[model samples]
Target: MGIVIIGSLNMDMVVRTSRAPEAGETLFGQAFALSPGGKGANQAAAAARLGAEVTMIGRVGKDGFGRELLEVMRQEGVHTDYIGQSETQATGVASIVVDEEGENRIIVVPGANLEMGREDIAALEPVIRQAEMVVMQLETDLSMCEQAASMAHSHGIPVILNPAPARVLTDELLQHVAYLTPNETEAGILAGMAVNSIADAEQAARLLLQKGVENIIVTLGSKGALIVNHAGSRHIPGFPVQAVDTVAAGDSFNGALAYQLTSGKTLTEAVRFANAVGALAVGKQGAIPSLPQLAEVEQFLKESARP
Candidate 1:
């Protein structure tokens, strides 16, 4: 089965700063760049680069950013037949700042992204039904996410939910999610517990499993990621690299995990592979531009495999 990505596509404006700006304080940026981004688009690009036949279902606008974003996706080999254009609004946009510590802060304007409705999902039912895995993020409308999850579940396809920019998700949403990938902050939000360490993350994961999520993957940044299943929990350590930008690392991890999982690898193997992918992602610049290809990932893995 192929991979279906139901999410958002946006133009990202990024700036580099020495530190995060204080409240009511403005700081001059060292550099600025524009790129094609959005959690959905990032993940789709990541998967496609990792050799997955990825189909993206999202909306753009009748704007220059939309045109450029679509062209970028096409160049990356993602199927964009389901991606639409809206005349009523501009495409989504994300304003991001990367700090000296490689950390980032972002603000998103969900223009046409928020307007994706059940109708959009219904139109993609046929494609969704044939997918091995359907991946989604919280960048789009919650109603659209729920609809896509419900439709995929009905066809017995596994659904992977990346509940980023975390919010209170319903039990119904969790029930349909075969895999829930959340960062530490998002885990705490959904599990209603403080997650500061691997142990704390494990506890939060258990709470989410009890809440009906079949499995949970909690991202721990430089500490790597924690993969939890019915059998047990394991921490997949991240590779050490001088990070240039941490932006889109989580999205890379999620996409890599989805690609490997659908390729018939075990959860642990998939997570280990994803950890390497994420490590490589952060050591580079830009969002979609930083995603490593399958050959690059394999070479890195092989190099790291040696003494």
Candidate 2:
């Protein structure tokens, strides 16, 4: 069975700068570019490139961006038959600013993503139930996320929730997540503490585990990721690389994890594979454009293992 992703799709407008402009201040940017992005779309494309059969369920506007978004997904081998078009809303958009260090700040205008409703989830029941895993993000309406989780849980399907652009999660939603992948900042919000280090991430993961999530993986950029569960915890060390753009690092990680886990790799092994995927992503630029294919990732791991 393949992976099912129910999330948002957006076009990203990125600007490169020395530093993020101070509030109410305008400054000249060094460069600008447009790319296909959105936590959901990025993850789906990443998994597809890594050889997973992927089906994406979401909404896009009835506009050029929407058309291009579907084209990109089709080109990447992600099934787009479930993606819907909205008549009244424009496609979602994210305005991103990346510093020379590859750090970024983003503002997402959800647009048509907000149009995804509970009805859509119900309609996609067969698709969700048959998948090996159901992946989702906070980019879409919380209600839709909750509905998708609930449906997946009812059918005994594993659910991977990447709480990006973090928001407070409710108990009902937490009940269904088989794996919760949150970055340090999002971990802080969910765990109600500052997650600045591996120790802090562990604390945050423990807190989330107590809240009913079966497992938690806290993504620490450059430093790596920490996975915690009933068995114990482990810090998967990151591969050092000079990052050109960090826009989709976490998405790449999440995508690779889902693919590996469903392909019979253990959780620890999957995370290690995911780290390699993330390392490759930051070394390049753009979102979907930066996702590495299976052969590329394998070659990267092979070369990195050299003495």
Candidate 3:
């Protein structure tokens, strides 16, 4: 009803290490944990925590990880009634290594996620049409994103496209995106330039603008985010938080942004709320476990001064 997310669901295998090993040099890690993650699930849980009606559509393998993924979504109040189960592939999994500064490196093996095809999207045509907004990421098959975006756009539904696990995207696909949220590195790759600073981001945003995306939001991690559109560009500073584990922080931002936008907040206001959500996510651990509830966000906003 509020938003539909067509993305991936993976079980995160995380290890905490003092530092990542050099190429071919193995190092002992500090700790390890497993949790439900994947960009789609994180965003779905985020919006649900913020009181948005979230419907998630994707594919997971017919395995225990698949069942756990669904269970986590249901617990977060995300509607997973339409998700598919692939018989041949395994459930998607992400191998993550988080360092002391809360920075992380991730490698995703998109199992059943990559198995989703046109038939799956076609089956969810009604749900796509009914959504107030449709959100997607690059975790699954690019064609699936193309198909879903086109269908949502044709129905006049605004689509929020979060390009992550960065890669080059076609202009044909960008044209259907109402809002494009990409981090600095993703911006650089998509715009064919190196984004070394905020100025570089501005230049890249201009290039991305030409691709027909209505609005572009380039996240800057703790420094904040930059927004660009026909109206011009501006930077929104982020909150200062002592981050412990940064996994799923951006997903939190995207999820909160969608929730605030659907709740009638302006773009700037939505980004600000999302910044707070992201800030809260980093002060914890795991993926879904780190996403703060609505009450937590409210209290954090009241207690902590914005940066």
The residue ranges of model 2 lying beyond 4 angstroms of the native Cα positions read none
TM-score for each of the candidates: 0.98, 0.98, 0.98
Instruction: Assess candidate 1 and give its TM-score to the true structure.
Output: 0.98
> Ranking under lDDT, best-scoring first?
2, 3, 1
* Stretches > 4 Å off in candidate 1: none
Please, what are the lDDT tens digits per residue for candidate 3 over residues 64-115?
Answer: 9999999989989999988889989999999999999999999999999999
**lDDT per residue, candidate 2, 1-307, as tens digits?**
4999989899999999999999899999999998999999999999999999999999999999999999999999999999999999999999999999998999999999999889878998999989999999999999888989999999999999999889999988998999999999999999899988899999989999999999999998888899999899999999999999999999999999999999999998899899999999999989999999999999988998899
The sequence of per-residue lDDT tens digits that candidate 1 reaches over residues 263-284 is 9999989999999999999998
Better of 1 and 2 by lDDT: 2
Model 2 residue 194 CA deviation (Å) reads: 1.2
| Clashing residue pairs, backbone N/CA/C < 3 A, model 3 | none
Stretches of candidate 3 exceeding 4 Å from the true structure: none
For candidate 3, report its TM-score: 0.98
Inter-residue clash pairs, candidate 1: none
